[model samples]
Target chain A: MLAQGVGIVETIVVLLYLLIVVYLGYLGWRRTKSAADYMIAGRQIHPFVMAMSYGATFISTSAIVGFGGVAGMFGMSLLWLTFLNIFVGIFIAFVFLGGPTRRMGHRLDAHTFPELLGQRYQSKFIQVFSGLVIFVCMPLYAAAVLIGGSEFIATKFGVGYELALLVFSVIIAAYVVMGGMKGVMYSDALQGSIMFVGMIVLLIMTYSKLGGVTAAHQELHAMANVPSLFKGIGFKGWVTMPEFGWGQAKYDLWWIVVSTIVLGVGIGVLAQPQLAVRFMTVKSKRELNRAVLVGGIFILIMTGVAFVVGSLSNLYFYKHETVTGKIVAKTENIGVIAKKKRALEARIPCTLLHIDTNNDGVADVDVVEKGHDVVRDGQVVLPASKLMPAAEVKDLGDGMVEVRPRAVAFLRAVVQTKDGWMFNTDSIIPTYVTQALPGWFGLLFLVTLLSAAMSTLSSQFHAVGTSIGRDVYETVTGKHGHGIGVTRLGIIIGIVIAVLLSSYARGGYFIARATAIFFGLCASAFLPSFFGGLFWRRMTKAGSIASILVGFVITAFWLLFIKDEEARAIGLCFKLFEKHSLLLDKPNWAVVDPLVVALPISIIVAVVVSLMSKPPSEEHLRKCFRGV
Target chain B: MLGIESKGILAVYLLCIASSVLCVVYGLLSWNRGETVPDDVKW
Candidate 1:
């Protein structure tokens, strides 16, 4: 098929962004003075950077690709979760958690998140436990992100999806390893801005393309059985409703919404090594307080835009899904189509902008890792400009103009009809980005996404390196190693691991979808330990260890044995555990969202164990939560 | 999550506005950046 080509302007927008990011990293490198500079920007990130970093770190491909895709499949009611994410994840986390952590960190002279935990408890074991948790769980989140970005790209681009995954993962690992936290925060600020604008652009585009908000509501409401099937919320049989009170709701979307996705990342953020370090990076509490409002605004914009656009994805998917009768993929290819239109031939270049020149619809083929359909647009104009026109092309004004055959035909059709305009229902943010963006707005969109991806990737590397070096090394040995050189090596090791994991992601959107469930597991294990450590002065090492171990073990049992995704990710290993499942009605246990069960048990264990042993010293208790 | 208490909603808004304006004017006219910061302020 003669592929639909993208416009030069779009390509420039995306490619130019890559150049800018590399340039920023180079700038950060020049400012790098000492060990502290590389690790924590010499403990002097401006409030603006800190605020944006907190917001940027809070969201990733999981928000844009995975959770958003799930929302597309479901409904807009999940938007409440976005509100929760901002209030709890960004606001409370910063206002309540950051200051105490930063203050304690300063007192303890600690650098990493796990180090804070160890020093706080006056226990080497606690530090090791924290490190172990990060080491084990971070891969899941990282893999999920790698998978999300790759999946979006793969599905948008026509080439091998795994190859696309390799491309993005390598680029992220490269820059992050080189930049460190200084580089990460700077990039994060820029990326957070991109995500904010891009998402708002997307929300506007979705509603506009759907013929405005009222029209979208009408179209969605018009779905024959929607009202009867999902009567408001809280309906028992109506599994689609927000199933809160129905405690044991298996991998049900509602439970995932209220308990897992929002709670997992939200609660887990409080404990994240990468995030806690941000508090220590700032100079003073005034900066922290000032950043609070700014952070709230940033998150409100970042997450709010994501959730709003994510909700709109349902409209696009609803349109495509209910074309005839059956519920087709409750997602759309609007983003995909918009992105492909950016490429000269829908071939994803380093950068691309607003429209997909190739009409498969979506902004520049979504990050090529996620498998995508190379849908054929009705004849491509074959950009006369890209082809050099067999002569000097004359009278070509600025913006995208349909002149040649295919583009002319497509343009004529666009001019002729104005009925159905849906962003691609696919989960990638491109759908919203492309549809929401106005003319000449794509360059901004490119910068927006570029920033989000880079920001999250830098933090991931920081977490990975910190865990491996300070946490893992200190756990095995009794003392701190050379700080700067160790962290540098850790950075290298972290990048290598990311590259390896990206290369290994075999399934198409496996990483993207797996991320939410993985985050749920992180929540199940950590929320108890973190909360226990902070609140319960009586929590003992035994209780903490047992709680974390049991929490994770139960989570694993539920995921592999409990969930009904045997078909989604089929494996020979399932056969080994299938009949051996100690509890068969596990999915009934609401296995994916285990914190509803594990957290209480973890709390009980900690309290019981601490009582059995000597309570922590009062001074330790005071210092652990001092100044807050 | 941003749910405000209905009783003091306008009062809080008024306070926030008054504070914001005060900060803005102080920032614009302040001679010393460090002096502008509150004594107890951490960041």
Candidate 2:
């Protein structure tokens, strides 16, 4: 259904884009002759390239498709994340952390994030441990990005998932392995530029389609009472924040939206190793300073546009009407009825259908149908099957049969009336794009998503490769000069692992959750130490090590045993505790993100351990903080 | 403001724009301030 109007125009556009991307990778390879060039782009990258590369890598397809879909469900409240993304992700990251990181990295001659930490703390254990965490855990995040990118390609072009995964991985791997950081950043800038233009056009078109900005918001605000399940969990209106309180259902939406979605990503951006590594790629503090301006605008557009467009898409769906009807069966023979049900099931998109089988007042079961739209008489018809067990058929004699009248109900996408089917939130953006936007814009948006995915995957693969080659290999093998070969191998391995994981990982919400898990984990494990390393003179190697281990271990423990979303998905808590979460009995603890608990404890551990242990020698401190 | 009734949501919306403007102002003001060569380049 998504590939309805796609044709030679999309094919040519994608091919042209890929050709240019490969050319940029080749250019990066030509310019790269040394380890520095491969690892950190020789520390001479222009401000625009670094800024665009950083923004593009930071906001992946997860931010657009996954989180944008979330906005469609939750409303404009997600704009808080956009604010944080610009303020903390770009401005503070570039201003506060970027300068010190660049200066210190230069002074230490560090090539990677782990290398910088290892050299600063003068601990090989820190380097190896950090590298191992990245190499092992980063694949989950990379796979999420891979899944998002390849699925779009598969759907847009009608290709197999495996083929799309293979092709996407190979294109990124070729560039990342050959050109390294330079190749990744160069292509990232190009991708970022495309994404910027695409989002701008999307915003303009969306607002225009909805009769301008204020009118669109006003209409969305007025549709607050469109009854759905989200209303029960503290959703007030699209324009307002969810009702804020604690205990049971009172604050479930608030915690899930603010703590998990907003804060988990907002605060977590500072410590993302893949993003933090970009700050060290620039030549001087001036580059980082200049980067903030471009970075802020870039991030604002990327995420801000997505959130705004996502929430407004509901208005589009609400206003547009397809065919709405009640299903009536004509045959009552068991075999004939079964065959008809199967046929209908094979021809409808996966939608949530609410039907009341019993004579009670409440709907009993939710029927999810996964297929294509069933078009009859030039109108899309509601498809029914055994999936809707509540629907009963009766014989009216004379070879005619009919479904019970009570079982029949009208259906619309996402708009749940007393009895209607709802569209999957994940399908909101794609459906809106196909149904609302011009055909040309759909092609542009697809390219935008591809760029978002590729840019992020490149940075992730680069980080994974360098962590192994520069940090782990050098620490383990006690060899320094042969990083390029090992780094290329690491890139291949990383790509393979991501492709494998992408093959298995399914569902829409997984993209956003997997990304959040990685981000929250990184924030807990690395934030305190990273922040202290740059700003604190008293931080010691023991303190940093203790903080890293505590942060990582605590976050892992919470994700496995306490956090409901992850713990239930992992099933470890269920097996061990015989419950979905260890904190299932607790009011709001199960929903509170791991970062909220672990980051504070990590900071405390860093402080206490530093205070208890002897401080670093004056000479080492001076060496680490010379330029800062 | 902007047809969004909630002050909290409006604050967040405004902050996103304000932050970007702040970054521009900060970048322009500090563009040349940190360009000096380090006194000690030796590792």
Candidate 3:
């Protein structure tokens, strides 16, 4: 746990922050008088607030802790994602889509994103289906944020995970359900500001600790020759892109990094319901235009600092010596050696053991021994016969025997450490924060993480509520102008679902994968239809319906059947096909994200279907495109 | 540049900063261009 023994300071700071947040929620609740106010902040939100809300909701703990951890493992190649976030997410979104979306939303008298599309196409089915998709699919994302934040709170404050999850959900639910969009956005502005400041400090501290920016990166680059588990799968170094090639090993990392991490969330931001609805929160296109500046800088700082600091953390870990356990046996008996290995494994916090064979204090090989076989990189490098007499020894041919363990003790080097636990990539930022930075910064960073989580969760809950009240319930029951009660109820239900999912889902990459799943799903399901509705006047109701349905089905199919991470988690592909992914036999297809496949096909379908069907009525088009 | 050896990574790193500058320029240039409210709008 980070910030241990400083619980009093952290508690006071966290309590004060929560009080301010709740007060802002109360202010929003007091101001919200009508459906418009509750739904879209009366469509008169300040440009700064709207932009910050949009950014805060867009970047969650998933971006900082989850994706930051990814940066730690994959290195500065993730800077491409930071670039896309600023260019595509902020510049393109605000400049190209923001004005049109705002105009069309107002002209059509639409409140939510689904309502905009539904009113534009004059199809209640579009609204209801889209609402259902968001309500159903968004919980996974909310859970990711929930888990990320709760984990931090639990560790920082020494609370149980369950208690942290419950408290986190309750606080977010209270605000979102009461204040609605106004509360969500107001709180988001504050949280976003904190995140901005926190990230800046983190970057400055990191560079200073590592000498300077150039020196830090150079040190990371120099450590590229160090033995790493990812080296087999095309990882070259921390400062460079993964080795690019068509071979299976190289192509896998490239696809996962470029397609999934960079492009998936990059393009996916355009169609996020929580984010797009912010365009409608503003009065004029000028606000959206003005927002572009703030949004760009905010996103750049948030993602850029995270990725840079994450990559640089490698230098810190390499230079610092962590607690390690050394095991030796006087006798070279096979049974006695195996028993000693088991005891050593029980003592260590990590599963995959790394041994320093040459006594240089650096780990030479990461080995997973099964019975008498010593495996490295999934191959039996030391056969049972080799392990029989020598107790795991390899002659280096340079007169330096690389002995694992025989008559002498072998030094084992654990990776990074936190509270005596072996640190994985997910723990990199947290470990770095607790160990390297000043204790005061931990309090601020904790608040930053909480703010990130709560801000995003608040918007997600608000989106879910509005989806149910405006799109699903109204469309289904033919009710109009009366949705606040149902919306509040929906927020509660959404919070419960998220809490439940967070409790059940547990893994090393769970947070990152969940975030990517939602982002990729949103891109596949919403991007084509949303883009077509905005720019193309010819896009018809049938085209949108077909695109949404096809995009959704294909993405779902890919997640359940092709993507190894999701498929194995769901266990559906394994149940039916007896494989983690159906494309396990096929090379890179399994790793290829659903967004890459579904989004293009969805776009093509939208174009073909819109062209083939009767174009939208000119009168309707004029009404939708009134101001733009 | 920036102590990064890979040209690809260096380009991306530079582009991130450049794109933010581009956004700032665009936002400043167009700040007062689109403030007109549509007629017959109700609030």
Candidate 4:
């Protein structure tokens, strides 16, 4: 109910954007004649198109909506991810892995990551197993992206969440099922360009509205306070890194800043299947080389702008809003006051009740009286013994304290609620657009968000479908002839599964959290096997299978068991074992992610198991390692 | 000297923009080094 719009001009613009997207899908479908064309765009994509598609797929509403919203709550500490996205995701991924992946995939004639592994090792088992894992686990990720987009639309149009999700899912699914990889990439390129323009404009507007970069951040710095839950880290501490330590308060900050946000996401991007296949879509090493700058700039504009604007939203809210309690009038009747109290409680979202203690000019103290308090005309009374001091009012001694309005609102609207501050974080970006921008631009920005979600979702659906068709069905049935039909069926199935999962993918969760979770899962499951197959001559078939299986199992175990909140969400914690996380009790290292635990285990198991077994045959080694 | 917050904010913008520009320059400079498709790998 923030701001609803169905203006004629905005509606026309949205409809026009959708038409162009559908047309692009049709163009891709027209060009896609064979399985290869459907899967990898016939490996003839231009460098710019490849880079844009890769970047567009890599960044989605996860970065812009979920992470941006989080930035509003967590402050600028999240900017470390921008550095990692460029350096690790774009530079290392394209420069170090891109050329070799393209070469090796070509050498093996591999259409998918599972197919690549299966071919390199000459093992149908490795291919089918990897494909099964992708088919099963990828829906969680796709669902997260779906929710990110649908929620934004729901907020913008005042539609129900279910209806918004269905419409967005069906539209993206139509293009993905029809166009395949070629259509996905083409639409991705268009979307990426749109996102770039939208984000740059957004960042400029955010700064201009707040009076400039320095002024905005300075205001943010002033507004900083460590909420009670964080326990130790103050606002300044949240803004900066904790000095390296395992001590109580410092570890909480490090756990959040480093273990979860930075490393879990940063290092995890190297092995994403959707991103890896992008390298194979283009022709040469030079294409990848050329793509580096384009991808870097695209990501910077997409993610950098999001983080900047997201954090700057705090300044906007501070200047424009105040949290107000209902006005109390002087009266003498206890019965009328009791009735008014109940009405006020029902009316307001805030829990705090303001009472004029001395019947003075200004209403004196704000008390969060849960179930008991006497409100009478002119003055009110609460049991002095039970009242704990409100943190918003700092005691300056002499029975006097200064009250901070923003701080009080923060305490009431965020901390005092059952859900934490991050509960409202996901809505920040959309709310900003609707409330802050002009009407026409808000509609345009909505298009940018839809493009972000659709481009990524299309890529994900295509990747999952191709994995099932090529790696599982084709490998099992030995029918490479009817591959396109099988893949199209797989696309539909993937969309259905993702839609189902998204219905359960809500509740105070940010899209970026789900994104990072999947990235970490992929890195743990695929990195050891993929990197080993590429670089190590002695990496045997048994070793690769063992590594992949172990990595997948460990990542699943950690996410569904050790991460208490995630475990509870999945209905796995109490039913399967205990209700609480195993790591929740371990205060020093509770913030460490499953990827941290799983990746090393996968690598070690792969290396040790490979060396213990017989080396791969000379012919296999020559084909895989030397690309003979 | 500028405040830490100002410097940090500036760095985020500069780093992103600089990295992108450098990439474009490098790509343009090396554009001619790419070989045409080899016969065996031609799609």
Cα lDDT for residue A498, candidate 3: 90
User: Which candidate would rank higher by TM-score, 3 or 4?
Assistant: 3
In Å, candidate 2's interface RMSD is 1.9
TM-scores, all candidates, are 0.72, 0.86, 0.87, 0.84
lDDT (10s digit) by residue, model 2, range A1-628? 2524458978999999999999999999999999999999988899999999999999898898878878887888999999999998988898889989888888888888888888888999999999989998899999988977876787678678799999999999988888889999999999999999999999999998888988888888887866444666788877899999887766788988898889889999998989988888887788888888888889999999888988887677555322122222221211111111111212234423333333243333332322334458987663334223233335556433333222111112232211223343444566567556878998999999999999999999998998899899978998888988988998899889988888876553667778888899889988888899999989989999999999999999999999877787678878877888888888888889998899999999999999999999999898888768
Model 4 misplaced stretches (Cα beyond 4 Å)? A226-238, A242-244, A247-250, A321-422, A625-628, B1-3, B6-22, B36-43
- Candidate 3 C-alpha lDDT tens digits along A1-628: 3423445767888999999999999999999999999999999999999999999999999899888878877788999999999999999999999989988888888899999989988999999999999998899999999988987787667678899999999888888888888989999999999999999999999898888988887878887776554666688888889877664855788788988899888988888999999999998888998999899999999999988888877676555423122222121212212211111321221124344433545443332221255557999874543322222545555434443322100112112222232323455577667656878899899999999999999999999989999899988898788788898898889889999999986434577878888888888888888999998999999999999999999999998999876787788887897788888777778888999999999999988999999998898898888767
What C-alpha lDDT do the candidate models reach, one value each? Answer: 0.54, 0.79, 0.79, 0.72
Docking class of 1: incorrect
lDDT of 1 at A459: 84
Off by over 4 Å in 3: A321-424, B36-43
Across A1-628, the per-residue lDDT of candidate 1 in tens digits comes to: 1112236775676677777776777767777876567766777788778888877876777676666654544544445556556556655666567666676676666677777767766777767777766766576567666655654454434445568666776666666667767777887777777777776766676677777766655555444243221233342221124445444443355655556555655555665667778988876676676676666556555655555455554445334311011111222222222212111113211111122344344433211111123334865433322321111112233433322221110111110001222122234344434433454554564456546656776787777777766777756675665555565566666655665666664332344345555555656666566666656667766677677677777666555554444222433234675442334344444324555666567667766776787777787677555554
Error of 1 at A374 (Å): 27
**In model 2, what lDDT does residue A554 have?**
97
Lowest-scoring 10 consecutive residues by lDDT in candidate 2 chain A? A334-343
Can you give the lDDT of residue A296 in candidate 1? 55
Q: Which pairs clash in the backbone of model 2? A: A347-A372, A348-A371, A414-A423
Decide which is better by lDDT, 1 or 4. Answer: 4
